[model samples]
Target: MKRLVKGFAVSLLGLSMLVGCTTQAPGTGDKAAGDKKEQITVGLAISTQSNPFFVTLKEGAEKAAQENNIKLVTVDAQDDPAKQISGIEDLIQRQVDVILVNPTDSAAVVSAIKSANHANIPVITVDRSAEGGEVVSHVASDNVEGGRMAAKYLLEKIGKQGNIVELEGIPGSSAARERGKGFHEIIDKEKGVKVVAKQPADFDRAKGMSVMENILQGNKDIKAVFAHNDEMALGALKAIQAAGLKDVVVVGFDATDDAVAAVKEGRMSATVAQKPELIGKQAVELAKKVANGEKVEKNVPVELELIKK
Candidate 1:
């Protein structure tokens, strides 16, 4: 009986040791589970929060991050390239797993990208892509096609023959350049349709108003106006209303909610709706995939729709 009891005690001791090695402590197990959950930090570098398009994009990104269990940090450049570089540097310092950049200047952000690359963080370009780099991916609407769509609508509305003015966006942006190129490519071919005045508004509502006011001084026969973005288009609409111009068709880009309202009200002719939310969602999805060593395409194209009411 004594031997049996001793043997039983030894067996119990061995069993306790095995349990200690195999079982995790309560809090420790919870912590291990939490640690196993995927956690990533994403940096969003955007041009301006002033634009409703960017606002929607930000919202979409935040929602996507939350759904995927990621931490998102957003910084706005406020339309300044230098400020954008500074913002990117700050994001790098934070040691984010990936960066999503909507560059203020395509060329200016190249060095910033190189800096991020040195830190071994993947950079994904959104909206307006950075000029030079092996970025993980770039997601944006087809600006050239949007421009063509707008021009085609305007041409049809004006009976393909009239004087039109163009309020362009920022000088160095790919959005501005492509839109302008596409606009002129179509209108330039129309014999009676003349682009009487063209000026840069820097994609600012107030600046667009000022530029349009100046153009109005010289060109009173303007049959239509095409502003690069909706904000600029809205500004020009204000100017046209103030100038008392009748039947002067106005077209714009980046169909924000306000722009859609404007179209519905018949104050604006049409807008190229570049769905920013979709772009934002795609951008975050691609960033996560790339970070996880999954394959993603270099270029993802977002659709542009011309909304006319």
Candidate 2:
């Protein structure tokens, strides 16, 4: 009977040892189910998923976040400033460790950015920047430079002298403002190039098409076109085609897959390429640095290039 009792105690001891080994404490760097305890949570508020650029940007951020073991929470603003503000407020309510925002409207986003500031949350702007509030870092390409590049390439294709139509992006966004600034900086200096039409398409494809259709009705002598983004460029292309107008040099920014394919097919003259994936990955890395109280550059720029056939 003593031997039987002793065997039972031995079995109990073995069972206890197994439990101790398997059910270790939550955060000892164990590859356990609750390993997220060691992760820093990051909140990503994107402008819109309707645009492919933001979609690719989100994928890059997610990839980097996963590689770094960061817990990421994403909210889409659907290109509405009010929705963006409310979404950011939700992120703040969640008390995320850091915030990466791709603002819909630079001016309108200031209120939401200020809210994040009030909550003591560090914010890092991705792609588009806010006009007001404090931001720890901003990650993007040199949009002004890209604008100049696109303009220069378009001028080269059109022989540097023509009546051109400019398709603008969202009015209040920094990208639209900066790219326009850069484009006019060069085009304004050239006396031979006349701007026949200038209008905003809100950086949307369908809007681009409709706006171009309207512009084409009045100004059919357009020699070249520069769109702030590829979506608009593609839309404008559709309008130009539907109107049976051929040989208009259509240049776009953001070398999205569709834009690149268009360029290859000789439909689009060229496009300025910005590495959105790199921007996203870098933004997450910078956010991690900010969370750990590590120093980082205030403005981080990704490279931009011109893509043509």
Model number with the top lDDT? 2
Deviation in Å, model 1, residue 267 alpha carbon: 0.4
Model 2 poorest ten-residue lDDT run: 28-37
Q: Give the range where candidate 1 is weakest over 10 consecutive residues by summed lDDT.
A: 28-37
TM-score of predicted structure 2 = 0.88
Per-prediction RMSD in angstroms?
7.4, 7.1
**Candidate 1 TM-score versus the reference:** 0.88
TM-score of each: 0.88, 0.88
In model 1, residue pairs whose N, Cα or C atoms come closer than 3 Å (at least 3 residues apart or on different chains), thus clashing, are none
Off by over 4 Å in 2: 1-37
